[model samples]
Target: MTDSARPRRATLSDVAAAAGVSQATVSKALNGRDDVAAETREIVLAAVAELGYRPTTAPAASSRRTIAVTFDIPASPYILNVLQGVLVAATENRLDLLTRLPPDRAARGQRAVGRDWIAEQRASGAIGVVGLTLSHPDALLDAASEASLPFVMVDPVDATHKRLVSVASSNWAGARTAADYLIGLGHRRIAWIGGPEASDAARDRLYGYRAALDAAGLEIDPAHVVADQFDAAAGARHARAMLGMDLPPTAIMAADDEIAVGVLAAARELGVSVPRDLSVIGFDDTPQAPWTTPPLTTVHQHLDEMGRMAVHTVVAIADGRRPVSRHVELATSLTIRETTAPPPA
Candidate 1:
């Protein structure tokens, strides 16, 4: 191999390093492995193209069978439950899964950079996508569409998004059910701990709780409705303020289990007894609910079911089939537990 006859060529290692994936993953992306995610595959292919990398052996296949799952964060039981279900479904379907997060934004309301990503997915032969929270979903949808890939949204912010497929629990009905359950237990004054006021799901739940009160001919005390970020700390913060009121609510209905857990902690700190002095209800029967000091009464939002459904939808699209519905909503059921009881006399 003389210097005149030899030229430097990019190898799999170079592509892998550039794409921030392993060599094996790059190989899987190019060779049509059923285990490579679409986004990762796209990244590999783009690197391959950019670096002018050529395979020493057989070239990549024409078709790629992979599903990509994206999320805002991998923490929290609600997200974990959904992810576990997706993993199970992927195994059952014999499909590869890839998970990624949106590029970090300097601030809110600014879209994440994604035009090149969609192009890469197309070139890399990605078949489908399950989006949890893409900072710039509109761009992704367009890119995915252009690449002939199907995109499914789990717990979308807006169910009425015309161009997207979304799967979620019935938030409105679930909130209403929780409130009604508290009322059934002879609790007249109930407080609601809600997520961000800007969230549609949170708004729906707040309204549902209010609707339940309205139907029962009970006035919803505006002061009782405190906003939280659907976390334990936020729940605690809001609960303290409410619990310190001139006349506190006999029961509290939380928008989510995390918030409810925080509320429970607040109750404990303030020496409020569960079910005896105060009844509590939460939404999203996450794993935390069962382990609380007194098991929390909550609305079961079917996180696992939603995850399974999301996988099924994306897979169907990959197989050249269309989903029966663009918007799929699973039913919510009330789980009666130790935290709720008839109001104290």
Candidate 2:
């Protein structure tokens, strides 16, 4: 064959060009530099694969298998705690953990995009995947299954598929316990500020709150129940609105510690002293829970354990072993602190 007719070999420049990044960025991504963003790295790798470009000096391949963990924006203390467990478990099991941000929601519904996303994981040497509180993961789940990759969700939100494997705390029981405790403290008018309705865990907690109120023979007040995002801002917004009412609740149950923090802020702004005029309780006893103005009283969900369990379960599935159960729920308990007391007269 004539030399002129021969195909040109792809180079690092080709990959950089394909990925719309600089050559230095491509190099940084290839070398596993921490300074490189995860999304940029993924893009570079995809470009390299598409162009069939081989690195001139490949790093020594480690024996450790990799698992990818995907999470959304605004990482919370709860997520960080779970990640700590996941990291510990991964280290103990001699596996590499890769953190990823999920693909754009707008393109998630397309079959080609979903398949490409899974293909990228495979190309990156990921044996399994763990999603932390991911929303609308149906397409990704389907793609992962088609690729024969093990997938586990840690406290998944808005998941419609029933055949998924997941690890979470006993949300309903935990919420019920918190509500029952408030009722026992002479709080007849209780309000709930919870996470989004799309979340299964959020729904379960809401149901638990309702159940506790029913058991106490209290009327279910629609105005007292609210479902919103699991953040301090949402908590603060809802708390302010409720506190301004003619008949504000004596106690409020927050979906998570962050929300509880916001509730505290709102109460302070409204000149309502906690446990004097109102009581408050929150879920996900995150580390920050104890640092509030008056330390928060919250339901403790074993966040680290949930993360560890997810890693173990996904690894087990990757090794061709069936989990004893598709869904696992860890126990939750109330951590009493200064934030809760009997309602004022």
- The candidate maximizing TM-score is 2
Tell me the deviation in Å of residue 207 in model 1: 1.8
What does the lDDT read for residue 7 in candidate 1?
A: 67
Instruction: Give stretches of model 2 more than 4 Å off.
Output: 1-60
Candidate 1 backbone clash number: 0
CA lDDT of each prediction against the hidden true structure: 0.79, 0.88
In the order shown, the candidates' Cα RMSDs to the true structure are: 9.2, 8.2
Error of 2 at 10 (Å): 27
Error of 1 at 117 (Å): 2.8
The parts of candidate 1 lying over 4 Å away from their true place are 1-64, 107-112, 120-125, 133-136, 158-161
All candidates: TM-score: 0.80, 0.83
